[model samples]
Target: MKPSTSSFNEVKKAIVLLSGGLDSATVLAIATAQGYECHTMSFDYGQRHRSELDAAVRIAEQFHAKTHRVMQMNMNAIGGSALTDMDIAVPTGGLSETVPITYVPARNTVFLSYALALAEVVGALDIFIGVNAVDYSGYPDCRPEYIAAFETMANLATQAALEGHKVKIQTPLIHLSKAEIIQQGVALGVDYAKTVSCYQANSEGLACGQCDSCLLRKQGFREAGLDDPTPYAI
Candidate 1:
């Protein structure tokens, strides 16, 4: 459903980080459901699966976001992760306790910094991100403590916050399992088929069905008792 149209002065604006993944798509739905004039942002930071960038565009249109911006940067220059560096292989093995090699260095931090800037310019007090500590690969930046720390820094670092406006970093999926996240998204009428969650998605946005991301997404659909509409290359 589309967010209700309101006058600019009465609009409740929010900047949503849309990665063209299941979680980010769900977060966009949540922000829309909350009656926010959503401005979605996606990054094309030299990721191997550039198909997700296309997916991001589709998702923003599907959700009827007020605005969608794609920022281009070269994270591959400092790449230690398999996602940004084609040389490093995506792990098909099961999840691990330690941080995986798939983790992009300071990715959320960089994304949030950009979001904070956009929020200031758009007069959006809330910045929505779909970071989950539960049902995720071991990414340090996805933790609750990290989000909290960043929110504190955002308030201190922004001109909007200096003028008595507080910036909130909203992570609605932070505490929810993948199953719960899927359920929420389905309830909000999110089209899972439009989202690409696989770390090594093909040019057509088809999942590899072997990477850590694909495994988690599969499990989430199974647990949610929903048929996964994600197109798989396997």
Candidate 2:
């Protein structure tokens, strides 16, 4: 769903793909702090970890986003990952070198398509996505090469490009490790407590404390020398 652009102004506008996770929340805070009128988008893509949606709203509000939009998508129907398919149990094991089951098929592609459409609607030239390669979950879509390819495709696919207004896909967190991301967010006064990273958080938004996401988040906080503020369902 597209949000009202009533708050959009002369300041530069940026479309942020916010997943309500720690990285995305930090990206939103970073974009807003950089003086962009942030238009945040979150997806209700039929994932088992739907609790993150609520956290997205909270983070958006906290950063004073120009608009916060939640788009309902039926990725469950095309599920290939454990996140959208209930039959495939979420892995509690540690991260692996290969692509994990939690990597939703073409999720970032679909997400970026929506963001591109919204950017055209609101005249935004910049789109920010929180896809990190370092300390990532081994998702193919999280790589910097993938983001660059998508950006190139977006520029060619949109009418805005014909008019000489190129769309830039900005992955500010792409190279940063989780610890570095947390440090950046801390410097920007981001409230990490409101973010959720568990692959299967409960309805109350408590982390399972076992999934890959939760483990990564825990490690990040520990490495950053900060307390983990997430509530766990353990």
Candidate 3:
């Protein structure tokens, strides 16, 4: 027997910002399991880590996203942050004051600008991003207020929103600790091996295990009592 037409029509579609990191991968799985036709979008923003992008591609393929678009937004022009700057060093130790060097200036702004464009083209009202405040890197854009402000901006900026179709920026992993995020993702059957969170992975994707990203990821997995799935020499 054929599936019901209503059933097919009822699938909620989402545009997910997948970065091939643990948080984003888990977000995609959650969206898929929740019945969203997830369309993933990643960017080659000239960051030090291409491994994360590669991992994103694998994660997108794992879910078989309706479509995956990797956009190239050049932020190499602005060398304000560590990820983009050769001079600055990625900080160690627990989360620090106001912001970290890894905090690219308006990184989320650049990313969300693209996500919004794609969402408009695809007519998807929901956008899933894996930005968290609990295990955050102190970027101002990672906060809930920032997201809310962006949502409001989206409502005003988009023609569809003006015409009554509103969009939602869903950060499911927001406000959750790294360990808690890991636990949730695992419970949701997210195979995190496909995700990469190292700030200093080599060309061959070997994680440095000392960068802030790697350290946090290690702590999270350890706290969760789960072995690290990333293929890194740590």
Candidate 4:
């Protein structure tokens, strides 16, 4: 959707972390709707689901982001997660109450660090991420506390913040349930079909319907009373 610019004399810039996933896509739509000129960033962090990188590009184009950048990093080198390590099988049985094997070590911290640097470079005081607490795998980093702590550190560590330009880490989907998130995205014209949330998506972006991510996505659509359009490999 076109960014709303009526309220501002000049459009404010914001950095959006796009993972080519449902949540991130929704976050992008929300950011645009709030009148930010979004600079979309995606990571090539050596994950098995490389197809999401391509999906990120498509989402960025559709959202008409001011700039789309894919940063390269080899998370596989330090891999403890199923996504970055091919040897580890993704758990398809169900979601776990504890942190799952899919939780990459300090992944969100690393991603946000890069995003923070990018924000400083681009003169953006806001960084948007799509981390959810409800209807999510129990990743510690996705919790509200973690985000709050990160934001606190960001303000202290950044030159911008020291200079009185405080940085705000935006988590629009953090408190929302999956169904609520989907409904909001729909209202903002986000095309959920284009997003790739599968933990084991094939090269063509067809999802393995059994993964935890797929399960949550399917349930989200069902709960929202919307038909899921994701292409599945099941």
Against the true structure, whose TM-score is highest?
1
Off by over 4 Å in 1: 1-9
TM-score of each: 0.96, 0.95, 0.92, 0.95
Task: Kindly report the root-mean-square deviation of model 2 from the true structure over all alpha carbons.
Answer: 2.8
- Compared with the true structure, what per-residue lDDT tens digits does model 1 show for residues 101-166? 999999999999999988887778899999999899989999999999999999999666776778
Query: Measured by TM-score, how close is model 4 to the native structure?
Result: 0.95
Q: Compared with the true structure, what per-residue lDDT tens digits does model 4 show for residues 37-109?
A: 9999999998997889889999999999999999999999998999899999999998887889999999999
Per-prediction tally of clashes: 0, 0, 1, 0
Quick one: how many clashes does candidate 1 have? Answer: 0
lDDT of 3 by residue, 1-234 (tens): 322333323557889999888889999988998889999999898788788888888998888899998999778688888888767777666566767788888888888878887776667789999999888677789899999999999989976676676789999989899999999999888888778887778776778788778888989999999998888865
Give residue 171's lDDT in candidate 3 (0 to 100): 93
lDDT per residue (tens digit) for residues 101-188 in model 2: 9999999999999999999888788999999989989999989899989999998997677667788999999989899999999999
lDDT scores of the candidates, listed in order: 0.92, 0.90, 0.84, 0.91
Query: Would you give me the overall lDDT of model 1?
Result: 0.92
Could you tell me which residue pairs clash in candidate 1? none
Task: Give the candidate number with the greatest lDDT.
Answer: 1
Candidate 4 local Cα displacement, residue 123, angstroms: 0.8
Number of the candidate with higher lDDT, 1 or 3: 1
1 or 4, greater by lDDT: 1
On lDDT, the stronger of 3 and 4 is 4
